[model samples]
Structure formats: structure tokens, C-alpha cells
Target: MLNKKKELYVAVAVGLIALGGAAVFASQSSSGDNAAKDKKPPASLTSVTISDQQATHIEVVPVKTYDFVEQNEAVGYIDFNQDATVQVFTPYQGRIRQVFVKAGDDVRKGQALFSVDSPDLVTAESTLISTAGLTKLTTAALERAKKMLETQTAAQKDVDQATADQQTADANFRAARDAVRIFGKSDADIDRLLQTRKVDGELTVNSPLTGKVTARNAAPGLLTQPGNAPAPVTVSDLSTVWMVASVSETDLPRMKMGQSVSVAVMAYPGKIFQGKVNNIGIAIDPATHRVGVRSEIKDPEHLLHPQMLATYRIRVADPVQSAAAPLNALVREGDGTMTAYVTKDGRTFTRRAVQTGLEQEGNRQILSGLQPGEKIAADGAIFLSNMLSLQSR
Candidate 1:
């Protein structure tokens, strides 16, 4: 019985040994499979050899030169063209009797913008009326004295004294008339005032030019002084506007007067405002490390407003000759580098990294990693990159 029990224990131990070996073998097999799955091809394997059938799908062309002009971009704001703007202020001190126009109102040359009840005009008119009455009375007295002298009823000295009085009155009336004219009274207006013995004290201030009003601080009964702050009205010719750009100081040397600029604004999407650099700031801003570049943009429609956000691009340099690759010949890699599929034998293509510059037309300016006359995949480069990535993985 003891021998049988020992044999039974030996059989159980052998079965347990076999089970342990099988488990170990299975574990090793699983680890080998995982390692094979995780293995990646060498990164140096960037070249791909394809059959003629595959080569037919890719459009390969020789690299050529392109004319590229460097441009500087900047953000800025829209503003009024100060050269065409004017502040309309009353020339004389008076309480505003009437404001004929408000902000945003269009005005023409010689159009009355406002009227002032001027006390100076009133005083001038009063003097003119008194002088006119005195002249009429003195002339009648002189005529009576001349008639009486002819009849010997008055002495020659009396006649001479009346003539002198009449002459003095005439001179005074002429001076008063001149004074009223200075107050903007026309000849006809003065004549009518003389006939009616009435005065029009309100003075009309006319616009100096054709423009649209930009601001209005004038109201009825508002006291205004000459050339004061917060001008009663501001007008500007809307045929043009200003685009002010803050350009980096490093780019200041590139900016020049009369350089053409293309501007865009958020308010008008897809519309370009064409302008030219009219002024450049003499001093750089210490806070922003930038300089102000002002451009005058034609705005015939008067659509641009002050303080609108805008952006602009100014071509600083002339066009330069450089190698250009077809736009589709390059592909952006996952590592953020640009890669082009280069080929010497036409069927065997290799990935070449390149540095690019301005993209104009359908070509990209190749600054480095490429040469003119080299064969590159002009199209279907993205396909090659995808195939290469899949095979490498």
C-alpha cells in the first residue's frame, strides 16, 4: 500500500511538471508576438521603389525658378484722412441760434451750417440805420438852404454850413454801410434794410468745402467761442480714408513713402482697400517697439470708419529669383517638417526635407533643400507620404 501511494504522488508531480512547461511555453509565445507587433522599421528607410504602374499615378516635373517678392504683414486701424478733415468753429463769439446740420450730415461748399445771433451785427445794423436817417435829413436841409440862398432869403455862409453838414453825413453813411458789409450783409440786403429800417442780426456760417460732417457739439442756445475745443462741427471729405499700421521697428528700414499697400478689415470680409504709404512716423514707440506707418486708402463710397480693425501687407522688396516646387509636390509631415518626394530615376522616389518661403501662384519658394532642374513629384506627393508611413509602421 505504501509503494502504491508513492507511485500515485510521483504521477501527480509529473502531471504538474507537464502543465508548468506548457504554461511557460505559451507565455513565451505571447511575448514574442507582442514584440513582433511593436517592432517599427528604421526611420532611414525614406526611399520608396515602385513599379512603372505606380509611377504613372504621380506627376513628376523638374523644379523651376519663380519670381518671389517678400512682403511684410501687420495689423492696424482705420482712421479719418486728416489732410481732408476740418473742424468747423464759429469765427465770432455768440450763442448758437440754430445748428443747421448734425453729425454725419453731408455739406457742400458755401452751404449754411449754422446761424449765430451776433450782437456785433446788431450794433453795426443799428449804426447803419441811424446814419441813413441823418444823411436824409441833412440832404433835405442843404436843399432848403440852397433854394433860400437863390432867393436871397438865407446868407451864403448858411448855405455853405448846410452843405458841409450834408457832406459829413454822406461820409458817415458810407462808413456804416461798409461796416454792415463786413457782417456778411450783401448789397441787396443792405438796400432792403435801408428801405424797411429793419435789421437781420442772425449771421449764417457756411461750410468751407464739400464734405460729410463727422462731429457735432453745437446745440440751440449753446455758447461757442472762436477756435475752441470740441468744435461745433467737424467735416471731412470721405473720398479717402487713412490706414495706420504699427510695424515692428526691425522692419522700419523697409518701409518707404509711396509704397503700395493692400489693406483688409474685419468689417468688410474679402474686400481689399488699396492704398499707398503716405507718411511714416519719425519716432518709434518705446512701449510697443514699433513704428507707425500711415497709408491713405481711397474710399470713394465713404464706407471706412475710424477705429475699425484692419490688416495690411506691403511689398518691401522687389521680386527675387528662386527655385519653386509645385504646391502639391510638398507634404507636411507629422513632425511638422515639410517633405518633398524627389526622384532621379523617375520610378524610385525619396523624401527630401525642404525650407520654403513665400507661396505665390501655384508654386512655393524653395529656400533650401532643393535645386533647379531637379526632378520632384509635382503632384500626388501626399499619396506617397501616406504609403511610406503605412509601410514603415
Candidate 2:
């Protein structure tokens, strides 16, 4: 039985060795297959070429030179030219009897705006009439007195008394006439008043020029005086509108009188009004440190009104030539600086720093740090940034 057990153990060991050998061979075969697979190149990396179909989809823009105008941008508010603003006030205390025009009404020169009731105006008118009547009567008396003195038919004392009476009447009449003239009353107006019974305080206010009424102070039945707290009305000529703007000190050197300017009002967007620089303020504001500029726009149709807010762009001659590039070519860095990619070859790009100037016509001005004819990556700059990030990682 011991011999049989030993033979059985040896047979078991042999079977175990055969199984171990088979397992080792299978492991080596699996490793060799893996090595062969690793030696083969990936399909994406080996001898790859873009297909004609893909090449047709690629787009490229050639670099070309273009004449561009450099412009400066600023924000400002609008104002009426002070010279065109007219403040109307009453010259005498009176009740407004009738208002011929209302606010926002257009008036012509010498047009009667409103009439007023005032005792002072009446008094002046009546006195003027009396003075003229007395002058005529005194002149006849003086003539008769002179005739009597020359003929010696009347007493000399009688003639002298007549002459003295005439002189006194003449002096009083002249004084009254002068008073009427000072009150803006015409001679014909005074004569008409003399024909009627004396009426106190009746006068009319008229517009001094053709303009639009911007403000109204004296309403019907309102009391007004010469030195009232506020002006009775305010009028402005709309034939020519004013665009007032404040320019920064840095840009003031480029501004000059008679330079062409274009203005846009918020009320009328998309419409451009053209004008010329009429005035430039000599003094700069201390608080804002800006200078005032005025442009005159022709408004024959009266579309523009006073006090309307507008933005003005003045075209001044640039002292030096500037470079410009497509807006998409620039990339802003995390540190607040901007960078652009310059194409060295068709496939490679180099990073370049650039300085910017005014943006006009959908292109940004490159003030410095970039030369013309340098091909810049106008598109896919973000892809380049991502590539750089991957390289860093």
C-alpha cells in the first residue's frame, strides 16, 4: 500500500507541473501580442494629410493696406448757444390781458406776443398826447404875440406875457414828449392815444426776433413788473441749433474753430447732423478740467430744440500716421494688457504686444508696438491660447 501511495503522489506532481508550464506559456504569448500592438502607430498620428474636402473649407484673408482716419471718442451733454438764448421780461408793472402765443410757439420779429394793462403805460401815453396838443396851441400864440409886438398895436407888456406863456407851455410839452420816447412809444402811437380819452396802463410786448418760445412766465391775468423775480418768457432761435460739448484737456489741442463736426441726439438716433465748430471756450473748468466747445447746426425745419442732449464728434487732423487692425485679432490677458498673435508661418504663430488707439470703422488703431505688413491671426486666437495653456501644463 505504501508503494502504491508514492506512485500516486508522483503522478499528481507531474500533472501539477504540466499545468504550471501551460500557464507560463500562455502568459508569454499574451505579452508578445501586447508588444506587437504597442509597436503599431496610431491612425491619427501616422503619415496623416488633410483631405481635399477639408482643405476647401479653410478660409484665409490676405493682408492689405487701407487709409484710415484716427478719431477720438468722448461723452458730453448738449446746450444752447448763450448768444441765441433770449430772456423776455416786462418793462413795467401790469396785468397780462392777452397772451397771443404760448410756449413752444414760433414767433416772427416784431410779432406781438401779449398785451398788458398798466396805469404807468397809460399815463405816459396820455402825457405825450397832451404835450403835442399844447405845443401846437403855444406855437400859434407865440406867432400872434410876435405879430402884435411887430405892429405895436397891442401893449408891450401884453405881448411879453403872451410870449412867456407860450415859452412855459413849450417847455412842459417837450419834457412830456421826451418821457414818451423813453418808454418805447412811437410818435404815431402817441398821436393815436392823444385822439382818445386818457387810458392808463395799456401796452403790448412783442418778440424781438424770429424764434421759438422755450419758456412762458406771464400767463393771462398774471401780474408782472420790470424787476420781477423771473423773466416773463424765454425764446430761442431755432434756425440754427447749437451743440455744446466739453472736451478733455488732452484732446483740446486737436480742436479748432471751423473744424467740421458731426452730432447725434438721443432723441433722433441713426440720423447725423453736420456742423462746424463755432466757438471754443478759452477757460477750462477747474472742477471738471474740461473745455467747452460749440458747434452750429443748421435747422431750417426746426427739428432741433434748445436744451436737447446730443453727442458730438469733431474731426480734427491727426498729426501722425497710425496703424489699424481687425478687432478680432486682439486678445486681452488676465493682467489687463492686450496681446495679438502674429503669424510667422502658415502653421505657427508668435505672440506680440500691441498698443491701441481710437476705434473707428469697425477697426482698432494700433498706436504703437506693431508694424504694418505683419500678418496677425485674425481668427482662432482662442485656440492658440489653449495650445499655449496645454504647453505650460
Candidate 3:
């Protein structure tokens, strides 16, 4: 929007040209005294009088106070909210066995995205199977030894030795089961593996957060290691996003963190993404004298996309309470002055010169020449000004 400032001024100039207003006043001279006396309209240069019937065609509105805030704009692009964006990689060293999700796919927390064949997990499961067999065999031997001792066949030392071996085997089995659990196995999975004596090495990787997958680097047979990048996949929570722009360093003084911002992008015309200023750059660019301004925008609907050309307006000052006039009530004069037709009654309107601040919400802020409760011509103001100009000329 800031980039269109020049266009806005040109548009206003065109509008004024289209409306040829009355001359400020008629010039009187000795040579044209008779002509002026012969054909003078019943109106002064800054005032006009119309019939009652003509008043109905013109719209009149009262001036009132409106709250207005000053805002500055910066242009930038949309990006993922980095705080919620994450790189997904394998938790252990392995070869990817399956890729369940592709880029741009939505996933839920704990949902599986891929599986990998982890050699470490397979080794742990294999040890668990071996320990289970040794534990069972030792248990049977210890039972036999106890029975023999009771029958006066085995000595106490022999029974004790068998009991010690059984305990050691059981401890080894428990440790092996724990090692497999580290590979993201449940107790139920361990039990099933033990029952079938099957050693499965495939370890599934689940999404750490509920979001959309933005990038996928994992594929079948791809080798992966913990903390390696280009990550297996990139998932990001797009509930919020960043709008970063480099604005003039001079504007930095008025801008600060936590200021409210309204963003517009080319992708979505007329839709505003509301956000707040989250950061202001400390360093300034020596070439451009600009600093980075970042805002966090809420995108609960997820309509925003990364890299979209975005421009945001941030309020730089507190709102000012001032008299506001409807767009139709203010007219641009031929001499480049803004004028409003002030009326004491419906039929008589005085052309009062006005100073305007900013135009917003279909109203032109009345910086001067009008006050609250004053009535002015809100529509067809040009007709009055033109009629007076024609007769004066």
C-alpha cells in the first residue's frame, strides 16, 4: 500500500480536474463594471444560494469526531513461523525402509511418516531372544538341582550354583529387553517378539508435531543418521507465520516490538492478516539505510503460503480524536485547496476552505475549518462550486 502513494496522489489530482469548481471570487474592473452589474449571480465568491428544490439533490452530513491512528507500511514476504517449524530426522542410524508421507502432506502428532531398518535395534532384539532361551534352560536346570538336593542326590553348593546361573540369565534377558525398548518398542511389541522369537529391525519414525510436511528427503533405502540434514522431512505448524520486511532505518524510532500490524499480500487481495511486531533489527544496512522488521501473523485458516509478497501497515502513533467529514463533503478546488460547503440552513452553503489530514474509512479527516456538529454538503458539492464559477466567469 505504501508503494501506491504516488498513484493515490495522481488519482486525487485527476478527480479534481474532472470537477471544475467556481472561481474564488469574481474580478471587478472599471472596463467591465457594466458587464459585472448586468450579469451577476445571487452568490458571493465563497458562498452560494440555491432554491429549496435544488437542496434535495445534495447530500448534507454533520461533522463528527473520529478516532484515527497513524500507520506506516513495509513490504516483505511471508514465511513459516520458525519457532514452530522443525526438521524431522531419524532418531537412530539406519537405512530408510519406507517413506509413508510426501511433501505437503498433513500429519498428526505421533503419526508415522517413515520406517527405517536399524541394525542396533535388530542386534538388541537378537540378544533378547538368545537370553530368553538361556534363561529358560537355566530355570529348568535349577529346578532339577533343587529336586535332586531334596532327594539327597545333589549337594547344597551345586544347587546354589544352579540358582546363581538362573538369576544371571534372567538379568541378562531383562537388560536385552530394555535395550530394544530404546528403539521405540512397546512392552506389547516386546512380548510378541519374544513369543515368536522374531527379530524385526524396522523402526518407524513418527511426526513430533501435528502439521504439514514441507520437505521430504527420506526415501526407501536412503541411509540416515541422527541429527543429519537435509532432514528426512520438514514439518511446520502454520498456525502462525512471519512477515519480514526491511524498512527505512529512520522509521525504526517509531516502530517497536508488540505494535499491531495489518498485512496484505498479492495472493489474497483485500484480505488482511493481523499480527504483532515481534522483532526489530539492531543492525542497519549501510547501502540502503534499512533495518529488518518482523511480525508474527496469525493464520489459523492456513490460507497464507510461504514466500508470498506481503506488505504490512504498522501503527506508529496513538490515535488522534478529530473531526471527520465524509468523502463527498470534501472537494478539491482548482487552486489545489480542499474545500467543504458549510451550510447554516439547507439552502445557503458557504464554501469554507479546509485542511485535511488523512483519508480513512471513507472519511477525510477535518484537520481545520470544520468542527464537530457542523453540517456540510456531503454529496454533489461540485455542482454548487461549478455553478458559482460559471456565473462569476
Candidate 4:
């Protein structure tokens, strides 16, 4: 009975091992079948058939070699023409008496922008008064010495010394007058001040250009000096604006001065601002390796503002020979490959992978994998791609 039991146990162990092997084989076969079902067709083999009604909606165009201008794209911002932007600073140190203009106020050249009560002006007036007094005294002394010399009561040396003193006094008087003039006072005003001996100690600031006041920092009783931050006022002439863009090193050769440029800002969609290249920087940025290009755009309506984000398109090529298709016909696949659908017959569209170059003005350049005379699906390329994706599944 013990021998028979050992033989039966060995037989059961062998049966169990066979069953496990069969199970693994069956699982692998099932996985292989699934993988076959999931495999996708090659791009060229993918095709789609649409009804006549669907065909009516699709646009078709022939790939052709075009002699058209190539456009290069860059991003940049709008800036005030620095040549027309001015920061106003007062030459005299003083306390602000009044502000005549506010931000955004249109001002003319020589218009008063603000007024200040400056002790510096008072000091200048006092100096002028003292110098005039000394001048008068010296003149009288010189006359007395001349008369004495003529009558032989004083020596010629005394008359000569007195003449020198008068000359020195005259120079001091003129310098004092100039010191007041530097504060924007007129000669007539200085003459009146000397006669009246009354000083106003008030200085008014004027605009240097005909522009809109962009900033104001003055207030009553606030002390101000030259070179202060947030300058007393800022004036900007907005008749013209600058659009600055960054061009990559690779695209630098295509850029040239006086080339026409089109600028678009988010604030105004569908509107293209016209401009021309004014300058291109020779130095490349160490951090970005990009060169700067500046375009001068006329803003007659003052619609553009400083620091506004803008898009720039510059025409680099002039009627160059190249192969291209309408931008609508290009499709981007899931594998990051660019493709376009071509057709030998109207009913069947074959997808072709293409290497692409620059895209501009509603057209894209095909570097390879496309012929000049081939017909492509221009409007419904995306729809065909979507249908092919569904059929593969």
C-alpha cells in the first residue's frame, strides 16, 4: 500500500507541471494576436474615402514652386522714441510751490509745467544787489581819483589802481546777473529786480517739447533737487514709436536696414502696423545670443504705447525660388512629424511625411517629400487625418 501511494503522488506532480506550461503558452499567443490588431499602417498606406457631399467642402490645391518673399518672425515690444522722450529736472533747489500740469495733459513747447519757491533764487538776487552797490561806489572812487590826478592832488598810481578796482567791480556785477539768468530769468527781469530791490523767489518750469506730460512728481511744500528720482515731470512726443525685436544669430544675415516690417499687437487684432527697419545692433547679447533690431513706426493717432507686447514679421526674401503649399494643408501628426495629404486620383488621398522649412504669409515651405505639381488637400487635411486615425483603430 505505501509503494502504490508514492507512485500516485509522482503522477499528480507531473500533470500539474504540464498544465502550467500550457497556460503560459496560451497567454503569449493571445498577446501576439492583440499586438497584431494594435499595429498601425504606414503613413503612405493610410487613405480615406469621403462622400460626394463631403468632397464639395474640401479645398484642393497643387503644390507649386513659388517666387515669393520669405518672411521671418520675431517677438518684441513697443517703446517710446527715446529721441522724443524727455525727463524734466529743475536746476534750482527749492520747495515745490505748485504743479501746473498733470499726467496725460497735452502741453506746448515753453508752456509752464510747474512752479517752485526756491531760496536759491533769493540768494542770487541778494548777490546782484550787493555787487551793484559795490560797482557804484567803485565808479565814484575812480572819478574822484581822475579829477585829483588832473589837478595834481593825487598821484597817477592812485588813479590807475582806482580804475582797476572799477573794472573788477564791473565784472563781478555781470557775473551776478548771469547767475540769475541761468535760472531762466530774462535780462529785463533782472533790470527790474535791481531797480525794485524786491525778489519774488519763485521759479517756473517750462516744457521743452510739444508733447503730452507722461509723469508728474511735484507737490506743494515737497523739497526737490536736480537728479531726483521720479523726475518732476516727463514729456513724450508720441507722433512716432519704436518697435524693438530680438533676432536669432541664424537669422541675422537675412535682416537688412530699410526692410519693410509688419507689427501686430494683442490690443488690436487683425490690424497690422506698418514700419521700416531703422537699426540693427552689431553686438549679440551674451546671455540670449540674440541681436536687437529696431523699427520706426509712425503712430499718428497715438495708438501705440510704451512696453506694449508686439509681433514682428520682416520680409527677408525677395521672390526666391522655393517649393511650398498653403499653410492649411500641413498637418502635425501624433509622433511630432509634419505631414500633408497628396492624391493621384480625386477619390483617394495618401498621407506623405514632409520635412518643413519656414512658414510665412499663409504658406509653408516643403524641404522634401513633396513634388511641385502634386495635388494636396488644402481645407480638409485635418479631417482626413482624423478619419484615418479612426480607421486604424
Best by TM-score: 3
9-50, model 1: which lDDT tens digit per residue?
999999999999999999999999999999976675698887
Task: Give per-residue CA lDDT, model 2, range 91-132, as digits (tens).
Answer: 778888988888899898878887788778777767766776
- Give the Cα error of residue 48 in candidate 2, in Å: 19
Q: What are the Cα lDDT values of the candidates?
A: 0.90, 0.73, 0.90, 0.90
Error of 4 at 149 (Å): 3.3
Q: Which residue window of length 10 is worst by lDDT in model 4?
A: 40-49
- At residue 246, candidate 1 shows an lDDT of 91
* Candidate 1: 10-residue stretch with minimal lDDT: 40-49
Q: Candidate 4: list runs displaced more than 4 Å.
A: 1-68, 278-288, 317-393
Candidate 3 structure quality by residue, lDDT tens digits, 301-383: 99999999998899988999999999888888889999999997878888899999987668788888999999899877999
Structural RMSD, model 1: 8.5
Record all residue pairs in model 2 with backbone atoms less than 3 Å apart, i.e. clashing.
118-201, 119-201, 122-201
Over the stretch 248-343, how does candidate 4's per-residue lDDT look in tens digits? 988999899999999999999878889999999999999999999999988888899999999989988676677899998999999999999988
Relative to the true structure, candidate 3 reaches a TM of: 0.75
Return whichever of 1 and 4 wins on TM-score.
1
Give, for candidate 2, the lowest lDDT window spanning 10 residues.
Answer: 42-51
